[model samples]
Target: MIHFDMSIFIVAAFLVFTLLVGICFSRQKTTFREYAVGNKQFTTATLVFTVLATLYGGGGLVRNVEYVYRIGLWWIVIMLLSSFGLWAVGRLALRMGPFMQHFSMAETIGNILW
Candidate 1:
């Protein structure tokens, strides 16, 4: 008797489930501003976790774990760059400055609405 490996199947199933959930909640008719900054649906905790995740890349995460396991609490210095990068991206992603647009977000942005 031969046994079959289903690891790939399990991963694919999980990915499909997650994608379905994302598709279900994602808005189809969102404007440029709304799509960029969201509708303020995120809680403070959620925002914090998102920022943390974005700031700490995969390498940083693994390195931090390794650092903690090997040395002491010194690798925290890496957080400075991460936090700065997150701040910059967050500002750009959230703050919408005045730009050339003769119509609404839906009608002007990407020209899909226009």
Candidate 2:
């Protein structure tokens, strides 16, 4: 069996490797386009995962898990409601990229309101 020290060292090494990977992907940006979207190109899978994280990265998952534990199968209603909300917003959010073409969310909102 692996010793505790070995397990800790393995976990630390994995974290360092992930940090290095993120650093290596960092880019020098001079243009708004490069700054808004990174200079490094992301493939379809990366984009999909990025979108998923953006949509659900908060305590949504944890809250849903708790709801499931406490209320059992009725959690499906909560999950479905959340999914439906996303689906409703998804179209506007998608068009947002091209419609306003703003580099930031604050900029987009300001533009929409003003």
Candidate 3:
């Protein structure tokens, strides 16, 4: 006899659904422009949120928390400085986007040097 648990079934169904969605999306090839700038229709608020997530996602927030816990307020100051640096780089990239067009970052740098 097989036993079925409702909680386990729900989790398994969700995992399968997510796996299918990933597989479906993975089958499509992203063009260089789409890969570089994404959909390009993101509003200012969306762009801000995306940038914030990119900057602080992955283990970045965790590492920042650890640094603050270990080193105190100065760690937050350092993070603020780095965030400002990221903003400057983003601004520079926006200015350079027209020149680079659909080029990847590595390709853009190569074109500049070579």
> Which candidate comes out best when scored by lDDT?
3
For all candidates, what are the clash counts? 0, 0, 0
User: Candidates ranked by lDDT, best first?
Assistant: 3, 2, 1
> Candidate 2: what lDDT?
0.77
Report the C-alpha displacement of residue 87, candidate 2, in angstroms: 1.1
Residue 110 shift from truth in candidate 3, angstroms:
8.3
User: What TM-score does each of the candidates earn?
Assistant: 0.44, 0.53, 0.57
Q: Give the runs in model 2 whose Cα sits over 4 Å from its true position.
A: 1-29, 97-100, 105-114
Give the better candidate number (1 or 3) by lDDT: 3
Tens-place lDDT digits, model 1, residues 1-108? 878679978999999999998998785677865666665568999988887787677997898889877765555665555578657877886645443333456645
| Collision count of model 1 | 0
Which residue ranges in model 1 land beyond 4 Å of their true spot?
1-3, 15-34, 65-114
TM-score of model number 1? 0.44
Candidate 3: tens digits of C-alpha lDDT, residues 12-109: 99999999999999999998677768757679999789888987896988898899999999998887777788778878878875564545667767
- lDDT agreement with native, every candidate: 0.70, 0.77, 0.82
Better of 2 and 3 by TM-score: 3
Leading candidate by TM-score = 3
